[model samples]
Target: MTQRRRGDLLVIGGSEKKDSDEERAILRQAARKALEEDGGRIVVLTVASMEPEPLAEIYQKAFGRLGVRQMEVLDIRNREQAYEPANVEKLAGASVLFFTGGDQLRITSQMGGSPLLERIFALHEEGAAIVGTSAGAAAMSETMLIGGPTNRSCLSTLAMAPGLGLLKGVIVDSHFTERGRFARLMGAVAQNPHNLGIGIDEDTAVLVSENDEELTVLGSGAVYVIDGRGIRFTSLSERHPERILTVHDARVHVLGRGDRYNLKERRPIVPSLERV
Candidate 1:
């Protein structure tokens, strides 16, 4: 059987520095990958935001400053727009599909089961890079964290829904430390112990390699990996909605820039100081 080829995915936490002249490493990496094919054509999807144009414009200038000459913005506002032929055509031949920060639910609701999303899946399988930030990043996982209390995790406190499922085996939470969402993420993993929970800090990102088995940390902040496979117990069914979540033996790994992780092995890979 022939296997499908998939592109790299950059799942970024919210609030990446856009106006800085120092170095836009994340955006630069995105632009460079897009330019490697299809004449550097990039399609920015602002479907997650209520005000899509403003967000789209921000990326336009950011990518433009990075020497990306060809770019298009698809501000898909509703389910109807997602099925439009014009919108579907915009994705054709694009080398990158970028999702901006906003409500992750908006992304799944509008684009789910639509032709536009199907086309995007096709593009990804054909080597087009899939990039998402903030809520966009959260929606990339199989399960999404919709809403919950920030500082604490309790049974029935978190609201979760099915995500876009472009990436799987994990649940993602963005702006993790800045917004105090650690507890909520822990609750999620406690409920679903088989799936890993990833909490990403602002300006940070986890780049899933093309093989889909590894992740490389990018940007200045940290990435928290919550492993529940070793979890011995969770008090989800035994506790009330507001009761604090209790999970025993859950392993946590904090990774910094240049750190690499093996998703399949569920372990962190130490970086070598020597240059390759």
Candidate 2:
């Protein structure tokens, strides 16, 4: 059997700095690095946003300032355009494919099984870098967090939908700390204990390297990992549908800038500096 080739993924939290914000430079720096490593051409997908044009322009200018020579915005509004051969061809020769923040459902619903999405997966298999922000980030996992209440209660708080499936065994939530979404993520994990839950704070990101299955935290904020694999008990299924849910012994880890985690191992990899 042939082994499947995997591409790098940069899952950014919401509110990434576009203009001159030095404090949040890590997010853009990681993007620039991805571009430099692969072909310079970038294809920006704005299908998720309601106003694709403005979001496209914002990224165009921002990336232009970062010295990205070749870039184009593919604002695929409907299903007809999503499967267009001409539009799919635009993704050819592109080294980076970026999805901007908007409604995650727009991306999954419009382009879900389209030829354009197939082409993107092909390109990613061939080593193209894939980057997403906010809703885009949430849509990278196989199980997407569509909507949920950001409250302490876990009962019926999360609504899930299918995602792009770029990253498996994980569900990503953005604007984590800013929106106080820890409870929301816990609710998601409670429903689907098989997958890991990753909550990323605003202006933060996690760079997942396909080669080693390791994730490196970047930017100013933190990344929270919720592992429900060790859960000894749960009231999710037994509790009343309208009642609050509960779980015991769900392992949690907090990673700041420069911290790294091994996805396959499900543990933090100590930094070299710490050992020295």
Candidate 3:
């Protein structure tokens, strides 16, 4: 057998809340599908510094119901247990690790560049998987957006902050379509037109790995991809640095399952592996 290739990363948006029983069923299937492709086990580490009770409970149930042999949430908020040896061991063996949504800055500030973060990166390097949603997902990029209700609500300009930079060249913004995060991501795109902007919608995820290879999509919502290379931006040239900035000329691709999304070519990257 080919030594199972891993280090695959998934970032997601929120799930749709509906009266229909089919809603969560679809989301759960999407979650399971994404997780099963790499490894069927998971260890969810809730280090985003968010409101933990409900999100943790919901995830625990979801992953467990997916029939994963082991599913857990490692609470690193407690200073006493933050560096505990037992915690480290649990994380080391996890096939998929999740970071809950909360504050992106807090997540990166607390965990980034640390031994635990190092271990997670190493696990990803060794072919284990990693996934995060909302704030959790946003913090994984090179240039993360730390503060924002968004440009719509704020009068001046959308705030952009430094990110953990785990997935370089790929800047992510969660809660895409539902909350209208495209403009904010576009602002970031303006900063680095060469980088790819991935705006993950509610109940959706974008899967990326090393290699200018395959990038896949999972879940109920759409993924907005903004490719700025070879495009002209008349607005970025303006000195006001305020309202009415436009990156009018870049190509944007929206992908769902069975569609290809490439990381290198910066468009609808194709899938290298057959769908399981």
Q: Evaluate residue 45 in candidate 2 and report its C-alpha lDDT on the 0 to 100 scale.
A: 91
Q: Global lDDT of each model? A: 0.88, 0.85, 0.70
- Number of clashing residue pairs, candidate 2: 0
Candidate 3 per-residue lDDT over residues 122-208, each given as its tens digit: 887777767777887898888887655553632224566777776788788888888877777777777778778888888777777
Tens-digit per-residue lDDT, 137-248, candidate 1:
9999899999988765456557999999977889999999999988888889888888899999998899998479999988989999999989998777644766767789
Candidate 2 weakest ten by summed lDDT: 26-35
Task: Tell me how many clashing residue pairs each candidate has.
Answer: 0, 0, 10
Q: Which pairs clash in the backbone of model 2?
A: none
Judging by TM-score against the true structure, name the best candidate.
Answer: 1
RMSD to true structure for each model, in Å: 2.2, 2.7, 4.2
Cα lDDT for residue 5, candidate 1: 74
- Candidate 3 stretches with Cα past 4 Å from truth are 1-4, 16-40, 78-84, 148-157, 209-212, 237-239, 269-276
Cα deviation in Å at residue 100, candidate 1? Answer: 0.6
Model 1 is weakest, by summed lDDT over 10 consecutive residues, at 149-158
